[model samples]
Target: MAKPQPTDAQTDAEPENTEAAESEARDPAQALADIEAAFDAERAEMRDRLMRALAELENTRKRAEKDRREAAIYGGSKLARDLLPVFDNLNRALNAADDQTRAAAKGLVEGVELTHRELLAVLGRHGVERVSPKPGDQFDPHLHEAMFEAPVPQYAAGQIIQVMTDGFRLHDQLLRPAQVGVSSTPSG
Candidate 1:
């Protein structure tokens, strides 16, 4: 028996339908492009997230280090401040002693001097420093507290005429500001 041939209606329908079916099949190049585009988008997003997390971690580390340094520098500020008067009294005693008296009390004076020196050295080792303002230096508000403004024509205005108390510093932090008298005169 002979095989039946397709009708005209079936033939016409096949051409249109065949083209539609062929187009629906995946194109290797287009599929590869789409896959690459998706991969690229995912990689970029992940990289952005990673960089932000790293930056935040670095910032946190820096802040912690700063806090630790500050704690080390100013930990004994109250105790150190309280000891200032003892040092002042020692200095005053040494200053008031005359040569004959100092010689007679040499051993005692030397002992007190040695103790005072050792105390200052220990404080210096721990980042504590004395700020001794000179008689003619300019008065700085950050390091000097003006107790009074004196009228003196021999020095320039704002010059430190007197320093009532010495200042102290623990690293970059001020433990105490120097008590000073600023000049009111305009010229030397």
Candidate 2:
């Protein structure tokens, strides 16, 4: 008679089964405690992984919301900047008109004036505002750019002496700082 060979699966599992049976037989309560401890360790590891995933998901949500808000606020900034030169050219034309020119071409001047007003109105609707600082006013580096510094007797040092062009602001952001000359005279 030929003896049947033990199957590979049965051979591999025999040692682990024997060890468990021996442990259980030695002290049943201790074996039960060991099983409970292993389950607890696995449960803790799974709980830690779930908590980390939840935290990452929350951070991604907050970052997405912030990006959406910034896009809404500053999305048109490039177009706004491009249109600034157009506004400056229009203003220059109006400024160059003297009393003689105005009298000679009153209708033409009026048309240009109307167009300029309309342009300003359109810009205002989109949150652009002029930052025209006058001479003798305090210079604000945030809103005005110092193109030159000179000792002017009429104004104290740090005061704006002249404004070459008006600045523009869109919401809290400055599109162009007012081109200015700050006084450099020593204050008494």
Best by lDDT: 2
Q: List the residue pairs that clash in candidate 1.
A: none
Candidate 1 similarity to native, TM-score: 0.63
**Candidate 2: which pairs clash?**
none
Residue-wise lDDT of candidate 2 within 77-165, one digit each (tens)?
78888888888988999999999999999999999899989988988888888899999999998999999999888888899999998
Looking at model 2, residue 6 earns an lDDT score of 92
Q: What value of lDDT does candidate 2 attain over all alpha carbons?
A: 0.91
Instruction: Evaluate model 2: give its TM-score.
Output: 0.82
- Each candidate structure's TM-score, on Cα atoms with residue i matched to residue i, is 0.63, 0.82
> Lowest summed lDDT over 10 consecutive residues: which window, candidate 1?
20-29
